[model samples]
Target: RRAAAAQGTSLYEEEEILLALIGGKDYNDDSKCKKKLEEYCQGLENASLKKKEIHEKLKDLCEVGKADTKCQALKTKVTKKCTDFKTQKLEQAVKNPSDDNCKENERQCLFLEG
Candidate 1:
């Protein structure tokens, strides 16, 4: 719980729900689940960093009066892509909660929703 909290994600709740769904059976090893959660958190952090970088770059461009059509288009495209991806993942998770892939989708959706 501390680790997930440090990562700025509520993964402990997700883990508990996952464990319940699996009838309390461990995922091969508890460490594997922890490792996976850590990886997911790291991935989320990296994505946020990238988003910040993009925003900063865009801001810098605008401040210098060089904000071009392409830059705005790219930003809009990226935003749309992110929204579409989240929606798709959430729909997949909701449509097939019992599928193996949907378990991962659920985690991704939960993180994105948060």
Candidate 2:
């Protein structure tokens, strides 16, 4: 449509308009998908950080005393974040299994799981 409007004569075919719309939609979808993948990556990083913090806290508590009162809650938080990260990556994989991002996420999930 923009291409047609920019033309000196302003002549445009219906098919050209439709194709432009379709092309724009495809570009938008790709952009959105890339954004989603970046968000998932950030989520995974956050979850890893949370889990590491919990581990460090647990270590500190163990060094200071034998009390484990807060251990369960911390464990639950780590588990939940790990699960959420994995779920997002898995969903991305299912959506675009052949994509590099999906494959990288799969690898990251496996590493995180182990």
Candidate 3:
């Protein structure tokens, strides 16, 4: 995180969440790392906003081309409280990649964590 921040790169949600999974921080009810999850949420919110802006820009530029659904959906998107259950499950899968069941879970975790 320090390296990335120093380089002007972001820690990103995945990295933060990974840190939480690895017991990098101390917290009560650490079963699900809230701080890490919050970072990811912030990142996602920022991304959703950026995507919305890009979609509008694209729509303006094209005039007759396809507009970005990602942006469009975001415009009318509903914010919801994230359930930590999913992350909890996936974090274990990622850490224990040696497990046979984790093979597919790891693949999925990579996708989700990204």
lDDT of 1 by residue, 15-114 (tens): 2343323222322344543444344435546776444554232223222323233233433443464577667765666676676655445444443333
What's the number of clashes in each of the models? Answer: 0, 0, 0
TM-score of candidate 3 to 2 decimals: 0.23
- lDDT minimum window of 10 residues, candidate 1: 19-28
Give candidate 3's root-mean-square deviation (CA, Å): 13.6
Model 2 stretches astray by more than 4 angstroms? 1-61, 66-70
lDDT per residue (tens digit) for residues 1-114 in model 3: 444455564434432233334323332233333343344445546766554554222223222221232222322221111234355565565566566645334433443343
Candidates' RMSD to native: 17.4, 22.2, 13.6
lDDT of 3: 0.37
By TM-score, who's the top model here? 2
Candidates sorted by lDDT, descending order?
Answer: 1, 2, 3
Evaluate residue 53 in candidate 3 and report its C-alpha lDDT on the 0 to 100 scale.
53
User: What TM-score should be assigned to candidate 2?
Assistant: 0.33
Cα error, residue 52 of model 3, in Å, equals: 28
